[model samples]
Target chain A: MSGTDKILLVDDEADFVSALSERIAHRGLAVDVADNGLKALDLAGQNAYDAVILDLAMPEMDGIETLKRLLDLNPDLQVILLTGRATLQQGVEAMKLGAMDVLEKPARLDLLLDKIRKAQANRVLLVEKRNEEKIRKIVDNKAW
Target chain B: MPWSPDPRWRDSDLAFFGAVTAGATHELNNVFSIIEQTAGLLEDWCADPEADVPAGCDKILNVTERIARQVQRGTELVRRLNGFAHSADEPCCNQEMNDLLENLLALMERFAAQRRVRLVFEPAGAPVTLTTRPFILEQAVFLAVSAALAGTAAQGIVTVQLTGGGAGVEITITGAPALPEAELPAAVGAWLGPPLWNLEGRVRTAARAGKYAIVLTIPKISEEVP
Candidate 1:
């Protein structure tokens, strides 16, 4: 939390993902890119990322499946889904499946950053709330 | 509507047109998808109202405009398709060669771009109007163009010229690579005469000055009957 947040970006379009990742990194966040969902899940397991930005229409374990696997590994992980064209149904489905946010492709960099920041903040709040609850329970117990 | 009539004849033409339109639209969709992704990236950058104006904005705008042109090109294709469909309904009519070429060019532009080839249309002295089935004329022109385009390389150019002559109107397609006389596709050379009524044309490979040209000629009429 003190240093720049680490973000995992998954997209099949290399040129698009490369440009986006560079732009996001320019905004002071650490970004690691994976071209497919499987690699993204592998990276998620290997690292504790602040958030994951995923694209839905990819070959071999798409964004939705990737999201499920990432959350399964770290249930508190924050994720944002990226879709192409005007897919409203997929966006809604992504949200229902615990995605922090769903964005249309060719999305503005600022908007993506805003969502990333918000998701990271919420993750921090969730962790802090759990810590506070633990402290309260400890104080009420006689066993140290 | 008649159950007695041959069902194959009823839907065959329609089905072929549909398939051609769908293929063209699918290619157009891919182009649009690239543009959409780039535009989304630009929008992401501009969302920060207070962020310092970046130097990349100009580049993004240029790409977006290019994408817009492609989308417009796609729209023109749909229009051409509608015209082509209507032409089928009125089989025999006065067909404007220039207008038909224009429509064919619009539809084939993206296809040419995809293959990295260039298709150029050169008009003669004046518009050569002929009395014939527009759809049949269109198919002939389309086939000729498709053949010429297929032979050319990605960077090659296929020139289509509409010239006025005493015998009739000559539609010449030059710049196609010379295929060995033996390699000509059997179907293309099988002499499928005038796919439409009142239209007489031939697809033959002629060599002039050591260059091969695929020429198609359709005779023009002076007037139309009531």
Candidate 2:
């Protein structure tokens, strides 16, 4: 992926988040970390990220709820659910709520990077499609 | 065994065991994941050709410290899991209420966290020994705490206070967004009924303004006298 691909890593585990963020940052990606769903939403609202790495289980608002709200803010946002105790039901629920993918805890770094690359590409395509529609509307409204 | 040999009890016991084990194992997994990432970062720093020697050494020290802390956490979790597994060794045994409750709260910490509820235990300051079926007693306490957690709202606190006297011991579990008086019986019954019966324990529920408290009174020396 490009060094400009920025991602948000959300989890309640402080050490885990810090370590993972460092590893991701080391690979030349701009990474932001949030310790809870609320903080994550705040960051997501304020900034644009190529992808979001979210934890499934959190204190108040879980990943599923976060995923819903994140999509509500920007439908094109790509979220990957990473959890320590993931179940099939939870995976389905996340996917149904617009999550790009579900990954279990202690995930392989290479696999996560691959997903992030895909997310960045998907995001670019979505933004381009939305922009194209806007230009088409402008052209239709203009005088000949 | 003084308690009934009903199949339902067996099922309850197994379910509790399974839930606790699964939660603890999940916690251990997180600990391992942190250690793995921290170590990996350290390795990355070492492999970088243009790495800043002094800065890299400092970062390496921090990562090693992080790994050590997580290892200590993992060790503590395993110790508690081991203690929980042995609680069912005998039908009845002498147990210290404070230690037992501490172990239980640790096991249930994840359950409380998932709901954004805090579980606080106030020890009696002295060991309260009771000759009882440890497993049943733990189940009863667990049920009481579970009921309190259900009634509490997000970011609420469920406090378990232990008080022991010459006669017996009292465990008061209180939570906020209290249930109404009428609903208390049903809520408490669903969780504490069978286990409380086996412990020869009596439960008294009270509403304190906006909080509800369930106080479990058990004789210091169980009538079973095993």
Residues B90-161, model 2: lDDT tens digits:
877778888889998998998889888899999998888877778888888877777677677778999999
Q: Compared with the true structure, what per-residue lDDT tens digits does model 1 show for residues A14-131?
A: 6566567756776778999998877988888898778898877665466788888888888888998866532577677777888888877556667888899888887788788889
| lDDT on C-alpha atoms for all candidate structures | 0.66, 0.83
* lDDT of each residue in B6-77, candidate 1, tens digit only: 223223555436545654665455445455555655665688675554766777666577667667765766
lDDT of 2 by residue, A1-144 (tens): 332389999999999999899889988899999988889889999999999999988888888889999999989899999888888999998898889999998888889999999999898888888989999999889943
Worst 10 residues of 2 chain B by lDDT: B1-10
- Estimate the TM-score for candidate 1: 0.53
Candidate closest to the true structure, highest lDDT? 2
Clashing pairs in 2: none
The DockQ-derived docking category for candidate 1 is incorrect
